[model samples]
Target: MSDNQPSPDTILRLINGYWSTGILGAAAAHDLFTHLEAGADSAAQLARRAQISERGAQTLLDGLVSVGLIDLAGGRYRNTAAASQYLVAGRPADLSALARLKLTHMGNLTALPEVVRAGGPVTDAAVEVADNPHWGQVVPAIAAQSVPAAAVAADVLQLERAGEISILDVGGGSGIYSATWLERNPAARATQLDWEPINAIARRLLAERGLADRFTCIDGDFHTTDFGTGTYDIALYSHIAHQEGPEDNIAVFTRLKDALKPGGALLVVDYVVDDDRAGPAFPLLFASEMLLKSKQGGTWRRADYHAWLTKAGFSDVSFHAAPPATLVIAR
Candidate 1:
């Protein structure tokens, strides 16, 4: 192929991209980055440190080097700057859990052929509040990684300085948004409505932030929970809508509107595609992720959200671009 255009085989290369994913997963599983950080540079040294065979270590490290995940010079391997920052054990943005989460998605992705043929998701499993077995691991894992993004969202929301504003954090995991908002609006207080174990985590995080007295944690399912009418100044539905389909989202937004005071607003943060659904990449991949885990959920377009929010009786609905997702606010 000439430099002016890419080769058709590029699509085949992209389709078989699991080679890269597998390399990262195996490295994370064996604590390869951590070992490298601790001064194991040679393949034999890393192998002995990880208690694996030299040949296996050489193959893994070579692949990582080829992928730019690591650097090899003079027969010594080292984590690239990006890898050191995100893959190492102690780095603040350490995404080892996210890496493992991607590996978990492999099973669902492998079933895509069957899922499409059967005209339904192969697995309908999703995280739930009642009698949940995955929340203990899943909630914290997701919340820890996602809370920073929520902080970025808080900036975009630019919450008013009005004191005594009450917010209801729907499906709020660790109450990070509330904490962030409370930090900005000193007089504002929040009520977190989420599942049992996740609510417990929220309470702890709020207390740690010294905002426990300003916040309340309520453990219940979002669908069945009774949100007292006209009780809240604002309701934050961050990252929760993508788990529900068209009808469910419409119904939930209606409930949320009722839960709000007459002039109150509802804020929704979710992965949303444009009208054409062509791609911003993340939302598209997330659509597939939802298909793997959810029975009736996928990323929606902004137009979909606007239509549903309007049908739910919310006016002044608008969508704004946010990293990896879009923000919808309606009153």
Candidate 2:
């Protein structure tokens, strides 16, 4: 083949990608990174700590080292900077919990081929964090993962100028956005609605930041919950629309529009696709991931959002700047 001809390197790399994912998943499953942080560096030491065979431990550690997830020097292993920041448990930004979730949901991907063929998820929907013990890590990790994004939300929303704003944070999760907004606008208060597990997490997170006094937690599913008509100055739906199909999102926007006082704004942050539905790779891929997770959820286009919001009686729907996702504000 000529040098101009394409090679199979990329294809082979994609095929072998799961090898590293499995390595990291195994590490998280056994709490291997945290154990290393606790000073169990040698394979034998890590093996004893994790209750695995020495050979298994050595192979796992070596694979991690080769991937730059961990470093090995003088026959001892340690976490690399990236691993230390994201794979070690107990840190605020640690993603070990997501890794554990990947391990727990290993079987969740078995239906993917069928799902793709059928154009929808084929597996039975599982219980949420409220009922799943395996999601204990995932619950808090969701909150931790949103911290920086929440900070960005605060800036983009211009909470400082939303004087004495009353925000209804729908499907607020751990209330990271609420807390961030409160930090930016001490004069504002928020009502956070989510499941029991998330509300419980939110209470503690807000309390720790001394913002508890600025927020109230309401426990229930956002789809079924009563939003109290005309009760809020702003309604926020962050990273939530992609989890619902267009019709459900339209209903959600309608309800949120009713919840807001006249002239109040409704903000939606989501992975929105361009009108052509081509490229903008992240949103396109997120659509597949959402499809895998839910029977109906997938990324929608900006025009889709505008039409839904407008159909919901929201006038003047417009886009605003928010990194890593599209932000739409309607009044």
TM for every model, in the order presented, reads 0.82, 0.80
Each candidate's clash count: 0, 0
Q: Write the per-residue lDDT of candidate 2 for residues 1-331, one digit (tens) a residue.
A: 8999999977886677677778888888888999999999899999999999899889889889867898888877899887887778887667776776666666666778888998887766675445566444566666656665666667766889878989999888777788878988999999999888777888898999899888998988898999999999989998889978889999999999999998889989888888999847778877767767777888989899999999999889887654457778899
Cα deviation of 321, candidate 1, in Å: 2.8
- Taken over the whole model, the C-alpha lDDT of each candidate is 0.82, 0.82
Best by TM-score: 1
For residues 121-171, what per-residue lDDT tens digits would candidate 1 score against the true structure?
765554454567666666655654555566665666666546678899999
TM-score of 2: 0.80
Worst 10 residues of 1 by lDDT: 122-131
Top candidate on lDDT is 2
Query: What would you estimate as the lDDT of candidate 2?
Result: 0.82
